[model samples]
Target: MKKTNIFKIAFILTIGLASIFSSCKKDAGPAGPQGAQGAQGPQGLQGTPGPAGSTVLSGNGTPTSTTGANGDFYLDLTSSLFYGPKTAAGWGTGFAMKGANGAAGTNGNKIINGTTIPGATDGSIGDYYLNTTNYLLYGPKIASGWGVGTSLIGTANVKYSGWATSTDPINVGYGKTSIRSARINTTAITPAIINSGVVLVYARRNSDLILPGGTTPLPFSYDLSVVENIKATVNFSLGTSVIYINTTTSNNSLYAEATLEYRYVVIPGGVAIAAAKNINLNDLQAVEKYFNIEK
Candidate 1:
C-alpha cells in the first residue's frame, strides 16, 4: 500500500509541469500601438558662388588687348568715341561721342587776383585782374600799371551830359541854298564808343522842343519853320556824334537849319544786338521803357 501511494504523487506533479510549458508556446497577442517616430537627420554642405559681372575702362586710343572680361565698356578719348559691352569675341563697334571737329578757338588770356592793384608785371597784355577789396574788374593789362578799375555794377563809363545844340545855319559857297548846316563841338564823344559800342538818337524842334513838323501831327500839308528856304526839307546829318538837325529835300536836294533839338543813348555791344531786340526808334515811350532812358 505505501509504494502505490508514492507512484500516484509523482504522476500528479509531472502533469502540472506539462500544462505550464504548453501556455508559454501559444502565439503572441496583437503588437502594442507603435511608439512615437525617431529624431530627424543632419543638414547638407553649402554650394559654390558664381563668377562676377563686367567693368568699365577708358584710354587715349583704341583698345588692343582682350585682357578685360566679358560685358565691359571702353572709351577712346583720342577719337572721342565709345566701344563696348565687350563680348568673348572682342570690343564692339565704336561710335562718336561728340559732333564734327570745330574751328580752333582763340588763345585765352591769363588772369590774376589780389587785394592790391595789379602791376604791369603781374600779367601780360590782354590779361586781366580783379581787386579783392572793391570787387572792381581790371583787364587787358597794358605797359602801364592798372588804370581805373571798372565797377561791375551801374552803367558803363558813359557820361550823362545835358543836351548840346548847334549854332544857326548859314548858306555857304555855290551849294548855299541847297545845303546849309552848323558844326557843334563834341569833345565828349569817345573813339572807342563809336568803334564798338552802341549809340542812339532822338530829335525834336524849336525853342519849345516840338516835333519836326513843329507843334503838329505827322504828314503836315504845308511847311513849318521855313522863314526863308521853304523848298528845303528837314532831316538829320548823322555821325558828328549825334549830329546836325539839317534841312534836306527830296533825295536830289539839301540845306538845313540848326533849329532842332536832339538827344542820344549809348549801349555796349554789336549793332546787330540792337536790331535783333527789335527796337522802335520812332516810339519814344517804348524806347524809354526798354532802355531806362531819361526824357
Candidate 2:
C-alpha cells in the first residue's frame, strides 16, 4: 500500500511539470504596431546681430514747398546725419560739414548784336560784346578802346659804314623806339635781336676795296675775306624811344642801310577791349567772308 501511494505521487508531479513548460513556450507571430512618436524638444537660442553696412543717401532735408537755394538745403543720409550747401550760419549742431558743389551745366555759345562794341569795362576778358552803332563785329579786345579797326603806321632809316664800331642810334619817322641790337659775321650763324618793331638792314660791298686777301673773289660771297661781309643787328625800345644798330666790321669794304616800319593805335579812355567769345568761330567766318577769303 505505501509503494502504490509513492507511484501515484510521482505521476502527479510529472504532469504538473509538463503543464508549466507548455505554459512558458511562445508561438512565432507578426510584430505588434509601432508606438506613437514622442513630442519635439524645446526651440534653440537666437543668433548674434550682423555688422553695419555702408551709409546711403536718404533724401533732401529741405521743405517740399520751397526750392533749395545755394545755402538753404541739406542732404539726409541713412545714418540720419545732415550735410550741406554751407551758408553763413554754417553747419550747426545736428548737421555735418558742407559738401562740394555738383558739376556745372554746359553753357550755350554767346551771340552779340550790332556794332557799338561793348566797352572793355562792360565784361570780363574772353567775354564777347557787340557794338550796335556799326554793323561790324568787334571783339578780342587787348586794351581799352584797342579793337580790330584801330592802327598806326610810320617809317625811318639808318646808314652805317664798315669802319664804325659799337652801335648807332636811329630815329625812325614813327614814334616807336628801339630795345636791343647785335651783329652777325661770316663765322657766326645767329645775331641777337630785340623783340619789338621791325627793322631790316641791307649790306652791300662798297667798291673793290681789299685788305690782305686773294683777288677775283666770287660775287656776293659771304665768306671770311679781307672785305668782310658784315650784317647789322637792330632792336627798338618801347614807345617812340631810341633804336640801336650794330655797325662794327673787321674790314671797311662793307656798308649797311636799314629801313624801319611800325604800326600802332590809340585807345580811348575807360574803353577796354573785349576778349574772344565762344562764338568766335562764327565771327571768324564772317570776318573771312568780309575780307573775301571765303566766298
Candidate 3:
C-alpha cells in the first residue's frame, strides 16, 4: 500500500506539469498573408541635362577648285551661306568679297567745241589773234563773241577785282557784275575759207579733282562757274587734221579777254544755240560744258 501511494503521487505531479505547459502555448493564429505590397510610390523627377558638345558644320562648304587654262573658275552658289544678300553670278575663287565701287569723279569743268579756231589757245576769244593762217578779215572780239575753230575754243579773262564771296554780286550774279570772268565755248566754228586753222580744247578743272561730297557721285548737272578755287585747262584733239585761224595782233592783247576771266552766265538759250550749232546735239548742253562723266 505504501509503495502504490508513492507511485500514484509521482504520476499526478507529472500530469499537472504537462497541463500547465499546454495552457501557456495557447494556439498561434495562422501567419497573416503579406498584404499586397504597398502601392509603389510615384517615381522621382528626372535629373538635369549635361553640358552641350562641340559645334559641327552641317553641309559641305563652297567648292574648292583650280582655274583652267582659259582662266575660268566656275562655282555653283547653290549652297546656303550666312553672308548677307544673295551672291552674284560669275563670282571667282578665293571667295574674297568686294567692297562698293569708289565714288565717281566730280563734274565742274566746262566742255566747249566750235568750228572756228577750235583748238586750245593761251588767250581768250577777245584777245586771241587768229594764227593769221585761219582768221577772218574782221571778226568778233574775245570778251564778247566766239571765234571760228576746229573743235573747241576756250578763253579766260581775269577781271580779278577781289575774291568774291558767296553773297557778292559776282558770285551770285545779280546782273552785269564786275567780277573776273573766264569763258569757254565749244563751237563747231568754221573759219573764213580765205584763211583758217584749227584749235583743240581740253576740259580740265583745278587738278585736285576730288569726288564730290567724298561719297557716291550720281549723274547730275553742276555749274562750274559757281565752284570755288577753280582753274581750267584746255586741250585739243586733232585726229588726222591741221586747224588754223587768222587774227590781228591788237585782238590778242594780254589784260584783254586774253587775261583769265572768272565770270560766266547761265545762258538757257545759249546752251540750245550751242547744241544746234554743233554736231551731236546731245553732247552740247551747257551742263555738259561744265563736266561730263558716265557711269
Q: Model 3, 1-295: lDDT tens per residue?
A: 9999999999999999999888777754678888877888999999999864423122345533322222233333444332222223322434434556799986432334333444445344444333333222222335445433322233121011111111111112223322222323323332321133322221212322322332211121222333442322221222222211111122112121132112112223333344235333222222233222111
**Which stretches in model 1 have alpha-carbon errors above 4 Å?**
1-161, 168-170, 173-176, 206-229, 235-242, 249-256, 271-278
RMSD over all Cα atoms, model 3: 26.8
Sorted by TM-score, highest first, which candidate order results? 1, 2, 3
Candidate 1 has its poorest 10 consecutive residues by lDDT at 215-224
Against the true structure, whose TM-score is highest? 1
Write one digit per residue (lDDT tens) for candidate 1, span 1-295.
Answer: 9999999999998998888787766755777999999999888788798887778788888886664777888888799789888887888778999988899999889877888767667877788888775455677777776554654444444433345556555544343344556544454446666667655555555633234443321112223334533454544444535445454443223322354445555555553253324445455444444444455
- Model 2's alpha-carbon lDDT is 0.36
lDDT of each: 0.57, 0.36, 0.31
lDDT of 1 at 257: 37
Badly placed stretches (over 4 Å) of model 2 are: 1-95, 99-111, 115-127, 130-137, 142-146, 149-295
**Regions more than 4 Å wrong, model 3:** 1-165, 168-263, 268-271, 274-295
Residue 213 accuracy (lDDT) in model 2: 31
Better of 1 and 2 by TM-score: 1
